[model samples]
Target: MVDLASLPPQLRRAVDDEMRRLRAGDGVLYGDMTSEEAHDLESADGRALPPDGALDRFIAHATVPPADVAASDLAGYTLVGVVPEGPGLDGPWSSVKRVYRRPDGVLVMLHEWAYVAEGGGVLGVRELMNASVRHGTARCPAQFAIRRAPTGQTVSELRWFTDAKVFTLSVAQDVLADGGKDHGKAWMLRLAEAIE
Candidate 1:
């Protein structure tokens, strides 16, 4: 069953709106209702919203599949997902997430964050930290490390700029837990080069 209880409010709203659109005639060529009608029908499932109006949480909605939010910048980001494995290496992906933008056109974040797997095998990727932009575009040269966080946990972080996209892929340093830091660093560098 689809589970989206963890998405931030704005991302969740994106998925919910996409769901209603897909179910309405504008998308599926089915549904005997106008877009507004379908939206209201979906909203009927909501109850006393919080001070935020709560929007449509969709948690109480049916257990069917979650919607694929293909709107604006959100769609442009996940077109080619960033995961280490070849095809089907990490099992099906969880929900796609992006930084929220207020209706007035201010971004909650400058870069995006997303993860492909979870737990010990998780592979995470985010837009390069503090990357500078020229003409509204930013690109980062390849940089990688197996640094120990302040908490002393080893992490494998790989950053690369290619195809006009800058991404950082990270996982636990377990890729070489048995191997020394030298080996782990090599592995991370190779992985970074392999990323598209």
Candidate 2:
């Protein structure tokens, strides 16, 4: 077994933090068992282990599912929410959105803004217009795709980029697929009203 103590300080710290988080019920730890091992275990007693028992053991090992799985598989535990506008690199007020794998799963966040003209000049207008033409349509300017550990289903969210300001939105898989679509469309319409 790899000696945790022999790892670099940063790696050790990260491992420690991850262990703590997992123990706190914020996440699950699963072991990396090969297909052969799984088959052997399943065939050992001529009967399969209960589903919950298998899940519990897998969680204990801290196993991460393969990356190829789509996020849609873990929809039951996925969540989404909007982050409030806040200060930014240039100044105050920016919008951001966050997606959670499980209620406590790692959060994936996205930020976006409209392309604005810098000055009342033809060049500036042309540049801004070009950007708007490419990214400012009914389609969401910002989006997120997530695949939860252990189960590789994919969940996604799409949102309007709107103005150069910030806003946050959060939701779960069903909401993201259904309600979020409407919400994003509405946001796009509102943005068009403001700009056009």
Candidate 3:
């Protein structure tokens, strides 16, 4: 269950709308669907990653188990899906992802993977910032701001690197809302706890 009262007013209304859609049987709840299907929805735009080889690649490259998001970590959320990337035998080319959804349509994705430093050796600041979270350790960290979207909506993003891996958790910021600042903060902390 989502902490509805804590959500910003507009978000609360949006969540309520989603619930009504669910009760009307318009769409399926993530908890009721297969993991693979969920992964497909989330990763439709990324490199295809099936379950079998994905885990092994992540374990080899990342300092922590990036694919280990569990029910306990997402108590009130649904384990909507997972996807993996670049699981080739060479260079541990792979990443693991887990996506969670609140009862409403709000979504948060937990993604982890090793960075592929271009030009070999050490990665350049700009390259690191673009490819992974811009934690202080990165050659160049990402620059985030409360920029306005085309729709005139404010977007908020926070990224960081930890234990040699990148972790990014974002919310679709809405100008009408508080930009989900608290929500993003809490989820990032949860993801950080999973770091080894």
Per-model TM values vs. the true structure: 0.26, 0.22, 0.44
Please state the error at residue 75 of candidate 1 in Å.
23
TM-score of 2: 0.22
Model 1 bad stretches (over 4 Å): 1-140, 174-183
Clashing pairs in 3: 86-93
* Candidate 1 lDDT: 0.33
lDDT value, candidate 3, whole model: 0.44
Q: Model 1 Cα displacement at 110 (Å)?
A: 18
What tens digits encode model 2's per-residue C-alpha lDDT throughout 52-84?
Answer: 444334233321211111323233434343232
Per-residue lDDT of model 1, residues 40-138, tens digit only = 323322321231312123222212222333432333331212212212323233222123333432221111122322222321223112121121243
**lDDT by residue for model 3 (69-179), tens:** 443345566555555555454434445665566566565555655554321222222211322332333332432222243333333344455435555444344312454
User: How many clashes show up per model?
Assistant: 0, 27, 1
> Poorest 10 consecutive residues of model 3 by lDDT?
24-33
lDDT of 1 at 50: 37
Cα lDDT of candidate 2 equals 0.31
